[model samples]
Target: MSKRRQPSPSHPTTHHGDPERSFEPYKKAVILGLRWSNDDLDLVKPQAALLETFRIQCGFETASLVIPSTSSEEALNAISQTILELRQKYDMDRECTCHMATLFVIHYIGHGVSETEWEFDICGTRRPDAVRIPWSSIYIGMKSDVLILIDTSYSGNFLQPCHSLQRILQNNDHHAEYLFSTGNEISDQNGPTYDKNNNFTTRLTDLLYSVSPTPVTVAQLHEALCTQANDPSTKLRYTPQYMDCYKPSIIIQHVEKNDYIWKIENTTRKAQIPTGRALISVCILGNTVHGQVKEWQASLSTMDSDVTIEGVFNLQGYSLCLLSMPISLWNSFLHPGYNS
Candidate 1:
């Protein structure tokens, strides 16, 4: 966790640490997907889906649901319940040998305001000022790290989202880190191009699910997010910021090697494949090349095809090994049928 600064003209997407597939430090994780009520906040569902996919791939077995919280009451209740659960888990872990930290994730998607201050636009009727959730209450009582992935422009600073978030974290007490998209408010006036998430939501999920079975670290995730933000074609107003509340890369997720197995098997592929791997999609974590690196991994999966894979992997025959057993079911698993 470092202080905020403008990203360099050229920051390589390659990571420089050795991370494992298992989300070690954090033994348990809870993803609370806040489905923002505003129609313009479509990024909510996909944001939740990315984390839900990451946790499951990281070998975590939890019964948490990733559905959007419709009303403010539902949102607050979900937040309360999540914090309480983390507190209990933290207390219980204290008594155990493997006193691992718990990862509390909150995916907030909707019309968020940071112009005069920071808050989420729940509904247009009272959108800008009505429903404001204090930052402290968001993770109160929890004794572990909190990772909040907000899909909103100007999350901390309405016009200067990064700077606002920086000042807030400078005086924050909780152990947390946030990944926010830097852009203008989403309204009828020059709103975000949600159509082809090839640059945003798509990259987000791909970055996490890149190396399945192999753990993906927070640092690595941050690097990928930054890479996308820095790219000019995305038309992002500000460089996406990855600010931490004094924590480390703890949460990790692993998906699969072939047949594009993962992230709500039925999850739709709204973006075109960015690699040359034919219909098969592979996410390269760490370095973009095949080399002997400690933090190297790739999570491969197909988006719209249900083809049978009859391949034999031999570690002796190749540098990378395939551990698709865990996600073998996901290889051909069906996405929970949706009406989209």
Candidate 2:
């Protein structure tokens, strides 16, 4: 939630606070590796293994799916099914008190051809002969955090343009982060030696492994990758690009250690009013709470004397409340219960 600046050379990656303190890891991690041809399995297998190992080491149950040499239709079907399965898994995990946040990582390495729409060359045939699939064909319904890494040529085209306002406010529940190998340019998938060993995948996995013990968030990884790409000594050919909305930028942990940590932090640290105002969105079902606006305002005002509800308006199911506050009371609202 800090203001953006140029990527810091010194702060390539961030560290986890209090190593002695144990915290809940991601509820589950599902990795999807897709390749247009079987030949690309050489890169996919090891990349998937690295991701699985990294997630597992961070105290998460990991599942990996690597699909090779399939038709675009079949690939889309498989991806859809995987996402459906994840949605089901999340629903089941919700029954348990401990498990809440879910994370999915998708890595695609293959031929990319752009025309009317950005397409993946599933069969690796050039142009008209290619069995192409549009990047946005599959539906991603899960509200959990998604990290997608695309290593094909023109991979940056895979990311849908997001509004700057939405990127800053981050009001949406669904969160997705992206890391693309190239920005509208051809990615060096096969590398100069044609080994696929010295490209984005290798560099990414190396960063992940190196920033261990301390968890590395998507933003941190992106920053480090950008730094590496900009460094002339690294001799990187393609520039990697990442996009993320800056709400609560996801840490590796799905849940904090305990309620006591929040209590201690709140009591000890003085909340700085970063913006002096906050807009809170709450969803209420069945219009039951529509009549309780004043009561709600009264209840919130008790938390801090300077805290006052400026306005409350209902848009569809969401109630948007504008609050004038002297300090950052937003963190106080984000407890374990908010995850549900």
Per-residue CA lDDT of candidate 2, range 98-145, in tens?
245566666776555443322333333334444566665656666555
TM-score of 1: 0.54
Q: Give one digit per residue, the lDDT tens place, for model 1 in 1-340.
A: 0122222222111122243312233445566555444445456446656656755665343334332335556566766776576566645234211235556666655444444433333331224444544444454545545667655444433334333544443345335566655454545466654333543455667665665544444544655555555567866435444554433444354433246333322122221212111122223333323343322222122322322222323343243222222121121122222100
Clashes of each: 15, 0
What clash count does candidate 2 reach?
0
Model 1 Cα displacement at 162 (Å)?
9.3
As for candidate 2, its clashing pairs are: none
Candidate 1: lDDT of 202?
53
